[model samples]
Target: MGRTMGLDYGDKTIGVAISDELGWTAQGVEVIRRRKPEDDMERLRQLSAEYGVTNIVVGLPKNMNNTVGPRGELCIAFSESLRESLRLPVSMWDERLSTVSAQRTLLEADVSRKKRKQVVDKMAAAIILQNYLDSNSKR
Candidate 1:
């Protein structure tokens, strides 16, 4: 089976992660610094081809009360663009606490502040992807 890609799309950067070939686990790939939408789409297309990605999962940041705010709407729009560009199924996963969880994991691992900042987005992507995998497996 082909692997799935996970994305944590932020204002300044997009975190990328890919599932294992067996679709078991998620691993951080890299953080793409946002430039232009076309540039980002090209980069994503390249990564998808390189990693044999069959689908994409984008993290959707919602408010604590489970409401979709502006950021969430942006993510939805982004996902739609991805779907149109890649012709692949793009799904949004609720990522309310993924960033916080990633921060805690980094802290527990003794990662330095500066280092954590560099990798937090990608880590959050992994968390989002892993959560999706786990939930889907239970069904």
Candidate 2:
């Protein structure tokens, strides 16, 4: 099976993660600096092909009450676009506390605030993907 990609889409930066060739583990890949839609999609297309990615797992940032909001709506739209452009099955996994969790992790790692801001996006992407993999894994 081809590797799966995890995306943490945000207003300014899009964090990227990739699953192992075996699709068992997720690792931080890169943070694509947001640009025009055309440019961003071009970059994603290239990355997908480079890694032979067949599936995309995007983080759905739902509210604490498990309700969809503007951000979640935007994510759904983004997922739809990705599905059409990439021609891959796109799935959304819950990302309720991923950012917070990532922040906590950064604190534990004693990452400097400046460094954490730079890397947190990618790290959050990894956490989101790892959760998906862990839940879907079979013994």
Q: What's the residue-level lDDT of 80 in candidate 2?
A: 96
lDDT of 2 by residue, 55-85 (tens): 9999999998999999999999999998998
lDDT assessment of candidate 1: 0.97
Which structure among the candidates has the greatest lDDT? 1
List the pairs of residues colliding in candidate 1.
none
TM-score to native of every candidate shown:
0.98, 0.97
Q: RMSD for all candidates, in order, please.
A: 0.6, 1.0
Which stretches in model 1 have alpha-carbon errors above 4 Å? none
lDDT value, candidate 2, whole model? 0.92
lDDT per residue, candidate 1, 1-139, as tens digits?
A: 8999999999999999999998889999999999999999999999999999999999999999999999999999999999999999999999999999999999999999999999999999999999998898889
Q: In terms of TM-score, which candidate is strongest?
A: 1
| CA-lDDT, candidates in order | 0.97, 0.92
